[model samples]
Structure formats: structure tokens, C-alpha cells
Target: MQAFSKVLRLVELLLIVFSVWSCTQERDADVGQADKRTVVSLHLGIKTQMSSGCSSCELVNKYQWNFLYRIFSGKEDIEFVVYCSDENKREVEQNLLYDVLILVDKSPETDELVVCHGRKTMFQKAGVLDMFSMRQITELLMDSALENEQPLRK
Candidate 1:
């Protein structure tokens, strides 16, 4: 029954190949579905040396900025929009305060973080200069995104 034995081995090989192919296809489909999910927007405004005249402004250093940038840049569901006082003069001046209005809507300061879902403001925080504040902001953003995620259907 050499022919029968050969047939059984061939069938086993084919089954293994098909199982791998099926798993790969399922994983690809999951990734495609993830890409279709909504992306939340995070707007950040920071004052630079050029606009550092405000003595009361928060002291947001380069390292703090880089930390936020790294955490959000790698996330697929969050879109980070950074606005430097020196770099984006017009945009920051026009929309910084308008985009970030938490409890009391006032003028834009040195450091601000605004999380938005489409045009609506989901969360906002000001004077985010230290690592502790940054961590809080990160947790808030993640929570907001998770809250905004659509429930899956069975």
C-alpha cells in the first residue's frame, strides 16, 4: 500500500498549506478593517523662543514635545497636528484659541493640547509642559479614542 501512504502524506501537506494560507488571509482582513476605523485628531500648540515673551507661559522643553510626538506618531488611530508659535504664526494665531477652549474659552497660551473628533472638541488641556501632564494627556487621548470607537457586530 505504498501508493496509499504517499497519498496520505500529500493530503497532510496540502492541509498544512491551506491552514497557513487561511490564517494569513484572516490576519490581512483584520488589518484592512482596522485601517477603515476613524482617526482622532490631536492639535498641539507650543510657544518657541520667538514668542516666549509671556512670562506666565508654560515651559515646554524640546524633550517634552518629542515625547508626545513619538507616542502619538506611532498610533494608527490618532493624528497629531503640532503648531509651533514660531513656525505656524498665522494658523496658530487664527485657530489655536478657537480650537482649544476647555472650561473658559480664552486666548491661546504657550502650551495647549486639543483632542478632536472631526470638528468637535473631545478633550482639551492647557499648560502641558511637564512629563506628568504629558502622561495625563496621553491617557486622556487614549481613553477618548477608545470611547469613540464603534462597537463590533456579531
Candidate 2:
């Protein structure tokens, strides 16, 4: 009976150790994941003049931009920095010559999407707002994040 009790105690101790080890492993994994996460910054330069009736202004009010903002805002790795031409006159005058400019990760070395007047410039694989699909944007963002993970080339 004493031997059986000893064995039971050993099993209990083993289970406790296993549980602690499992928790440590999970915590390590979480930390690794946090390190791997890439921050994708979406810089939006918007025209605040509603009277201009520019396509870029119209695009801002459209459901697509709002929907995209809502979806991406919930993500852990994506950030949006909005710059209104009216509020940020110096920034607009210095960096942007268009009604709208969307820069990803603030890395001009990477492809950038510029929308102005009624035309849109493609950012590598991502097309203009009117022609760009949600899936394409998602892929673009994921691709950009992954690209940031790679070491810089000399």
C-alpha cells in the first residue's frame, strides 16, 4: 500500500512538472510570435476640401475606404496615419503633390500607391482604389510585411 501511494505521488509530481513545462513552452512561443510581427504603416494624405469634388475626396467617403480602415484598424500589425491636407498644410506641401497619397511602411524604396485627380498609380501588385480588390490589398499588406522581415541587401 505504501509503494502504491509513493507511485501515485510520483505521478502527481510528474503531471505538475509537465503542466509547468507546457506553460513555459507556450509563453516562449508567444514571445517569438510577438518578435516576428511586422508593423505596416499606412500613411494617407487626404484632401479636406469637399467643394473641390475631386475623385480622391469622393473616394474617402466611399464605403471601400471606410471598410478597409475598419478591417485593418482591428489588426495587430497594421497602423494608419492620416494626414489631412487642410490640417497638415506643411506636410502636404512638402511631401505630396496630389489629392491623395497612400504610402505603405513609409518606405519610398518600396512601391507606393498615389491617387490624384481621377487617376491612380499602381504600387507593385496593388492597383488603384477603384480597381483594387480587398484580397489584393490584403496580399499586398502581407507581402509588404514579409518583405520587411528579410535582411536588407548590401
Candidate 3:
């Protein structure tokens, strides 16, 4: 009878150890995998060229799409998409896939990009014309992503 009690106690101890190890594994998994990722979409507006002195257009012509491709194509975390518009900016605005939308256009402000996060406008000026380097754009996206990671308060 005493030997049976000892065996039972050992089994209970083993179960406790397993429970602790399982909890630790779960915590590690939560730490290893990122819960939130930032999605950025770029609307190059390649089709709309009104010759209205849009610096963005000039920059696009100067560097071309290859320039952007070289910078963002390898990134696994960011989702970038480009669309062409001959006259309408609404096409870019209507997209729901991205967390941030960058619109390159002549209207609203020449040589400026309209950056929106969800329904809120984040930046009225972005891109080469405003002296915003590709690195700066990356920084902005990271910041936006971090902001999105935060939980909203009631």
C-alpha cells in the first residue's frame, strides 16, 4: 500500500512538471511569433500624368518602378501593390487590403503623396519631391505598423 502511494505521488509530480513545461512552451511561442504586422500599399498612379508640375511624377520618371522594386520586393513582412490611373484617384482610395495607402498624384498638392492609415490621413507630403528618401518611407511604415500594434482603449 505504501509503495502504491509513493508511485502515485511520483506520477502527480511528473504531471506538475509537464504542466509547467507546457506553459513555458506556450509563452515562448507567443514571444517568437509576431502577432501584428504592418501592411503598406503604394499607388504609383503611373497612368495619370497631367504635366501639372507634380514632382512625384518627375521622380517616378527619373527613377522608375525598378527603383521601388529594388527596395521593397525582398521584404516578407510588407505587402506593396501598385495601380495605374489615367485620371481617377478613387481607385487607390477604395482599396481595403492595406493598413496604409500612399497616393502619388498631382492634385491635393503637387509633388506630394497622400498617406492614409485606415480612414485617417497620416501624411500629406511624402516621396522624392518632398526630399523623402526611400529609407524615410520605410521608417514611416515601421512607425505606422508599431502604432497599429497598440490596443485601443475604451
Candidate 4:
């Protein structure tokens, strides 16, 4: 009985590993496909600064990627339009929310946008909704885990 249980456990572990590997393969295969999308806009609560990897260009870049994710919701290639502006900082501060930590380690590469799946929304999408901070929206758009459709222009 003990040996049988151990074998069953091993089989379960193998199944789990296989499932994860298959999913990752599918995800990778799905990336870089075609899609219709655009970055609506990112109403940043505070402009990204030098401390983060975010360059002047990144502020808008983040928003662009987010727009694509919102519309496409997959790892497909797409040119997305972005809308960017400032909301009432006074209001954002009143709520006491700021800066999204995209990189766990404070590295320069982390400054660029990181994209990830499994999240339903980003900050830029909410226009004056007061639902979340602009920093978070920027983070979502910039997350490296998230995929990008178009080659960033020079």
C-alpha cells in the first residue's frame, strides 16, 4: 500500500509538471500573433523617475502595452494606441497610493514595461474613476511579463 501510494504521488507530480509545461508551451506559441489594439492612455498619478528603469519614453510606452492587453487579452502582436494625461494628484495622494514596484530587485532593466497575464485591469483604463492608483496602471502596462505587439519606435 505504501509503495502504491508513493507511485501514485509520483504520477500526480508528473502530471502537474506536464500540465504546467504544456501551458507554458501554448502561451509561448500564442505570443506574437496578430491583433487589433491600442493604448487608450495612462493618467499617471506621478511621473516615473530615474530611480526606476522607466525612461521619459517609458511613461507613454507603458500605457500603450496596457491598451493592447485590455483589447486583445493574449500574447499576440499588435499596434496599440495610448492616451496619457494627469488626473487630480491631490485626490490620488489623499488616498495614499503611489509607485508600483515592477522589479523586485532595483535594477535598470526593471524600469521598462513588464506585462503579465491573470489580471483583469490596469490603471490607465480608469479615467478619473478613483478606483486605483495611476502608478499601478503604469506598472501593469510596463510589466516585462506582459507581451508587446509592435516593435517600439526609435
Error of 3 at 95 (Å): 22
What order do you get sorting by TM-score, best first?
Answer: 1, 3, 2, 4
lDDT of 1 by residue, 1-154 (tens): 9999688756645543443344234435556444333233223333456756554333344455455555554545555544443445454444332222222222243344445443344445555456676776667656645665633221
Query: For residue 79, what is the lDDT in candidate 3?
Result: 44
**Candidate maximizing TM-score:** 1
Predicted candidate 3 versus true structure: per-residue lDDT over 105-134, tens digit per residue: 322221233333333334433334334555
lDDT of 3 at 44: 46
TM-score for each prediction?
Answer: 0.39, 0.32, 0.33, 0.25
The C-alpha stretches of model 1 lying farther than 4 A from their native spots are 1-61, 85-107, 144-154
> What's model 1's TM-score?
0.39
Model 4 Cα lDDT, one tens digit per residue, 1-154: 9999688756645543443344234445444531212222223323446544623433433444444445443323222222122332333233322232111111121112222232212222222322245456435444522455333322
Tens digits of lDDT, candidate 2, 11-115: 645543443344334334456454333332223423335444644342332344445455544444444333232444454345433323433222211112221
Q: Give the Cα lDDT of each candidate.
A: 0.45, 0.38, 0.40, 0.34
Top candidate by lDDT: 1
Q: Write down the worst ten-residue block by lDDT for model 2.
A: 109-118
